[model samples]
Target: MTAAQRGRRVLVLERANKVGKKILMSGGGRCNFTNHFVSAENFISANEHFCKAALSRYSQWDFIAMVERYGIPYEERKHSQLFCLSSAKDILNMLLDECSDAGVEIRSHCELTSVSALDHDNSRYQLKGHQNQTPLQLACQSLVVASGGLSIPTLGGSGIGYDIATQFGLAVTKKQAGLVPFMFSDASKALCERLSGLAVEVEVSCNNTLFRENLLFTHRGMSGPVMLQISNYWNPGDTLSINLLPDTDIIQWLQELKQQQPRSLLRSGINQKLSKSLTSELQALWWPEEADKPLAEFSDRRLSEIAQKLAAWQLKPSGTEGYRTAEVTRGGVDTAAISSKTMETKHQPGLYFIGEILDVTGWLGGFNFQWAWSSGYSAGLNV
Candidate 1:
């Protein structure tokens, strides 16, 4: 039987709102559709190789083709991030249109009340929901859970994915908000507040993983591309080291500064690269007593210490801004329970999970959306 003749009823459960709520708010309104370089190494999950199958099946080029087919103009930003020339609505329309063409029924404004499979007919599954005062029951041979993760609750992201996984004897990894802003220490918060709206190209590191991008100081804490990327690896009480001068070797550069202006004050010399307020903060931290002293008077050891401080300034974050401000959730349904090729539950047949519902979390740039399309498409094809 053909797909239509098979009468294969498929139900996709979306919360009362809509998909692409987060997409609309991402990248300053223009959605970063996908990234050029999407490797398994960039993703984080319990089973490392699990992402390889779906990613290979639906490559970045594949997503770009679909975007191009829709006549949506896109441009490559830094780090090969593809963004729509118009708005994020184009991408949403593409996904909805694909579902329509495939005869997949999407039920919005309907919350999933419960889901269970028939004990006798293992291939049969039932989904319960409500449209208004009347209840709705959807029965199908295949059931896919694409409810997403609990990141931005305002956008309708929920923990329903894990809850459903647990109902079916699936394991859920420890979940936390990823790609979020870092909340600073009291001292650091004050300093960040002083430097609010200041952004510089620098490197941010956490747990040995380094992100080279722009770090923006916000009124509440730290954000921007670099900080958001590194936020995945960061934990409370962990120090986030910042390399203010990532390209220029501070040690060698300081030596050059010594040769060029031997009698200049340390703060005056650093003023060339760092902001005046930031320079003052560093001077206060480095040389509170002799902050006004000339660079020529400093010994090699003191200069080395100062250079090291500038090269890698460490700050312990109090916590993250949490789901309210996070771009994605870090962990979810463990990958080991699902087949990498089809996203079907290994323990339970005819059951599938996709999108942010899985543990796999991508980097800041368009990678997560790529995972969504890839994993969603994988299950869509098989289901």
Candidate 2:
């Protein structure tokens, strides 16, 4: 749409049967289009400054203005995440409408077999592909690879973008799953399974990075905003330090409670801070021998031990859920070879890499979508 708006004929070849399949399924069908707050700090990249230029040029406010122009109703959720009020289809329709107005053509189910430079100057390019099982070929002045990363295969995620980057002699970084849930194989797995469907607001930390959000217990592992956010920095064998009661100093609170209610059971006092089921599980795991002990019966040293557990519960995950359920891929084409200002490849003229296909990965909110809009707009202006 941006390219077409610039008076350049634009053709979008989609490998899936439809365009924007990921958009349709994002944010529980009501797509989180962008965030109220976005900065380069919200993204992780080999080149930390690579996204700054494009993002500054086409910020979230720019996209919001377009959404408002279309009169699309939206609402801001937790962490300034902006989501469509009705459905994600509204955003898709708006883009499609823009494409229509700009005379952009979209061809679905077209898979590119190969791409090559047509001249020594590399000013022209040749693309060979099959559109819906029929052989198709085209020549163009510019080729923009917006193919997304490998996260959800059912959503049409593929590595073709990375493959193209490598084919062009651009360095590709090691890829891994980001914004994914942690799967445990030890006793933690049983605990999570037993507490499946429970959601608790907590601060989960890994590798010195902390995220204060809701942690959800799943039958297979743990998920929700907190786990997904911290997963970006977590690696295998790294133990996660979870603060079940982050806002309160557990030791101080417990000591005061013991003085005020000397006869109250420890579980009863702790239960006020967490779910009874969760408290029970913690009691069994951390202080099974003192389950029946009252506050007064527990020594200060023992109370401190329990307080430490509540303040910093440790859990080591065997691994993540992998790309099967990850929200995004962690790495891709190295940003060193891509022009941050125009998103065009420095080594390969007329070739641009944008969105998840690059080494940039945003935080769990709407940062990723903002990158897509910004990078796409930057490339569109120059492509």
Each candidate's root-mean-square deviation in Å? Answer: 2.2, 1.1
lDDT agreement with native, every candidate: 0.85, 0.93
| Candidate 2 CA-lDDT value | 0.93
The clash numbers for all candidates, in the given order, read: 0, 0
The positional error of residue 133 in candidate 2, measured at the CA in angstroms, is 1.3
Q: Candidate 1: which stretches are off by over 4 Å?
A: 1-7, 120-123
* Tens digits of per-residue lDDT for model 2, 140-249: 88999999999998888898998889899999998999999999999999999999999999999988788999999999999999999999898889999999999998
Candidate 2 segments exceeding 4 Å error:
120-123
Q: Best-fitting candidate, measured by TM-score?
A: 2
User: Tens-digit lDDT track for model 1 on 238-313?
Assistant: 8989999898788877877877898898888889998898889888777888787777888777888989989899
